[model samples]
Target: MTLALYSGNLLAQSHEWTNLHDEELRRRAVKAAGEKDLPALVSLTTAFLTVQGKSGVLTSPRTVEAYELGVRHFVEFATAQAVNILRPGRHDAQNYINTMLAAGRKPAGVHLKVAAASALYRALRWAGATEADPFREARVPKDPTPGIIKRPPYTEDELADVLDRADTHAKFLLFLTAHAGLRISEALNLHWDDIDEAAKRIHVRSGKGRKDRIVAMSTSLARAARHYRGLYAPGGPDHTDGKRTTPPENVFRYAEMTTARYHLSKAFKLAGVDFRGFHPGRKYAGTRLLRQIKDFGRVAAHLGHESVDTTRKGYASLAADDLKDDLAGW
Candidate 1:
């Protein structure tokens, strides 16, 4: 396999290469790939991968592996259509979509693969490889369309029981995610510098779009954060600071997503909570915060959402009490 590296535009540096219009660029990119220009192929693949990473879609290494699988499928389709991977035409893309649907791939799965392929073509075009976007004309299947999957939230009683049963770290993370409405990635990437103990705020420097925002911390979350801080303090026994005198940059080291999920799941199980995963912790958190604060704008800001509409879409489930109150009026 030819190793792909990301270096903006590779063909620009080649003396034998000539910059062409979109039409000719598409033809040349396909011709060069047919001739097996390893560097060109690598550059094209790397460019798309880089875009995926930047789009906040590829959050973990596992997701990247899945993207690679999608890439492989696209390459195979392009080869079968006798087209270059970078400039497969609309007909080729449409045919590939049909083939995938016929192969019994789930609509959601097919959509993801198609989106990845489309992104790849866009990147190739951006890099001056293609003229037209093949995906623009590709006919994606309409039925069984993919949509966002939202997990159910834990009940208030169940949430309390889980917190009551959780260990210090698990409890802390739970409160941070549940009450504070921090995404797992945002919470994991948090450092000591991001926290303001006196002010009871956490600064999110790099979030979904690399946007920075400050979120208010709950009292319980503040206390737990301080406790976590003590664990990393110099001379606090777990510290690696020389003479235990200096602080580390990060509060948690090598915080794997799997481990965090396992611990939270175990805690929920022990507490007899019905939740099967950690995302519900966030869902419940957002819902509870909205109810307690009764301010959509505040909840959106706390959750780092761009707008209140997004918060409502994700967490606006009516409670039994709400239904009961409405029925009373009838």
Candidate 2:
């Protein structure tokens, strides 16, 4: 076993990853991965997954969490089989996939777990930890069912009710997505200077796809913004600090997406509405706006989508009730 070679390197650098800061872990991990530093790669991968450092990274928390969960299952399987997890054979990977499927895990879920296991082996190979990638050709069952149905956007009446029940900060967050079509991340990242009350427009900085866009606010959204600003940005968009007057760096009182999501769900419960998630509000904005304007490209731009096709596919599906009036003539 090449474990003999790794044992010597581990003696010197086994504790190195523990001493490094979370921010420094990723840079060192990349270097370790590239230079085939197996001991460093092992420690760094474990450490990086544990803290995940900070926000605004290329990968999202959701993806990281999913991968973590998947890897845990593989670790458990490896332990029971007495297999060298880092040097698993192709049959070991196949059995793991089969076990997950046999246990009634969804096909998609099994696939994701298999993919996570495959990713670990790829890292190991890159770090010269092992040449074996059992998961490389492992067969994962295809999902028999179509993708999960997404929750539909809220109706205008339902959104209005939610707004009425929400307080200051929640109202602004909801309005940003429900009316202005800002993504939850974009909304949370907003600053007072990004809003233009006079022009009824918002400057979304570094939205999805790392693109900046200008979005027009609906009349109702503008009203909500004014009310929110009156309470939160009471400094009138300019605070005199020493000699300079600067807008607040962030518009919302809450900095984290989880905080914003919690408040939105609370408001939904209070309003007696089913709590679906933030995207519904954005879908409402795009779908309603497209209904009024009947223009795909215009609505896509308003939603900060780079392609009109995305806007059309996501927001253009119409229910039978929506077409009742138009079809009545036939």
Candidate 3:
């Protein structure tokens, strides 16, 4: 059947397209795109992405939000230029790119927006929305500086000071990332069952890129784990109070990443240290391990990195003392 016939039937069945769930919207979008029904295609795709966010297709909520913003920006630009959003020519796409660069948007930010637009086109094409992908060959400048130069890792002493100022819960959170090399999300989602204290190993399930790895915990991390478990774990010796409180499954009780970050930031404030972010703690772990073992491969494994080059490029940086020692020997 023609897309027009399908869209008419779809509209007749549902007065408000926005009310449909992601799956329903997805089906409608495919049909609308196939039929080349401009109004229905625009409405269904917008509703599918902005509201419910192409759930299974997109990896995270952050990506969904970024893509939605990117698409909105592109639509606005197209409208202002009297260009069709779904069928913009190369000239129009180039103009948008030039406009963004002229406005002094950072290279990374521009890349993200362009990538988001590219993703939107991909989805559309998959659903038979359009044959052209303007973003496919668009150029985006690269950020020349290395990540380590931008955000250096926290020193051992600095992390220690933050730990000293932190509460028990906050301390455990820091230990997971700084000492055990867990990502902030991994630490926040960690369950008691994932840890093998005696073995000194942590099984990280579904880390970045949907991959899992075994992370070795440091002595300090193990100590912190035991202490946290005693007071806060589901069935620990000191966990019970007078009333019956249903114990939480995850180790850290904070339900939101922002809340966890707030506590960590407060500790940094009390310790009189700058808050560079949680990833630096993970970097600290990687650098410290590399220093001890003199092996990039092991450090990469510990950091759950699929490539050793990533660990070397981003995590491994020479300590000031190490650099000085090499010069002193000369």
Candidate 4:
């Protein structure tokens, strides 16, 4: 136990992820928060992300992604209201929130943004920010819309057609996500060295929730990787004679998110399939896995969701017909 504790302390020191006591954390947050300029706010926002990441407070990249979006929204509203969010009052917060509700967006989604903003406030305060939480007195009206939100996954045939039409890189990305349910960031961060062809598994580093886990890759995915590596090698189509022109560490060379979106949109168009956005692939994987096992927990485990309810909320919106066989069994 002593040795293990020592090792744990060493690891924490190496990564600096140890959470400071409330007082010290607040001091650092306040130091980062005092600057109200755009650049300072941006830096503070980034600092919040870093502190959360190091402290294991952030679980998923999506959480970070959502926080970044919320911070941007907060900053814009602060600028418009002539208030610094770090030093905001109830009035400024209400005004900013009013715009969100006025836009006719659903309340649940808006609440997420508000929640993120509140989290930033707490994070800053812990770091020593002296400002009052503007959201303390604010209210986000409840959304009356039915809690269920569902989208149909792409059919196997439609997905195959998309793959057939996709460029090599896009094909790999789309196919992997469809079969393995890898989030786009996970897919993009995939490194060749992480793939275990023999075990048919890939280690997803710091996936959603900042947790590392392994997911099985299909045989076809391995084959596709090998084929792409060959083509993109020194003599392959993507590279020239330059040594520095070696294949990138990432399996897929595509980096721009917009470009991937455009490719998916175009592929769906050419394939004559209904486009339900890139998320359908993940939904398809989760739904199919749930169907086969009839176990929500198992399916959620594969998808890296800590709670089965979250998996159900996000991916359980299936059609009545998909359950015909199971219903018959009953």
For model 1, residues 76-119, the per-residue Cα lDDT tens digits are 66666677565455487788888888999766678889876775
Over 1-330, each residue of candidate 4 has an lDDT whose tens digit, in order, gives 011111122233323312566666555555545443433343344455555545443334355456656766776666666776556765887787889889876677788888767766765664566657878888888654323353566777888888888777677778667767887777777777777766877798957756788888778877776777677643467644343322566565555456677777887888887777777888778877776777888777777778888778776455558778768968
lDDT (C-alpha) at residue 98 in model 1 = 86
In model 1, what lDDT does residue 127 have? Answer: 51
| Each model's Cα RMSD | 6.3, 8.7, 7.7, 7.9
Question: Which sequence of candidate numbers ranks them by TM-score, best first?
Answer: 3, 4, 1, 2
Q: Report lDDT (Cα) of residue 259, candidate 2.
A: 80
For candidate 2, write residues 1-330 as lDDT tens digits. Answer: 022221223223334655656556446655654444544444444334333433313444345545555555666677677766655565888888888888888776788888666655654453444577787677876654423134477888899899899987688888899889888888887888899887999999968766889999878778888877776674754333342232356777656567878989999999999878888888888878877877888988988888887776665444448778888989
Candidate 1 ranges with C-alpha deviation above 4 Å: 1-45, 48-73, 76-111, 127-129, 139-150, 240-247, 266-277, 320-330
Clashes of each: 1, 1, 0, 16
Which of the two, 1 or 2, has more TM-score?
1
In order, candidate lDDTs are 0.66, 0.68, 0.71, 0.66
- Candidate number achieving the greatest lDDT relative to the actual structure: 3
**What TM-score does candidate 1 get on C-alpha atoms?**
0.68
TM-score of each candidate structure, all chains considered together? 0.68, 0.67, 0.74, 0.72
Task: Give residue 211's lDDT in candidate 3 (0 to 100).
Answer: 80
Error of 4 at 311 (Å): 1.0
Global Cα lDDT for candidate 3: 0.71
Q: Among all windows of ten consecutive residues in candidate 1, which has the lowest summed lDDT?
A: 7-16
The C-alpha local distance difference test score for the whole of candidate 4 amounts to 0.66
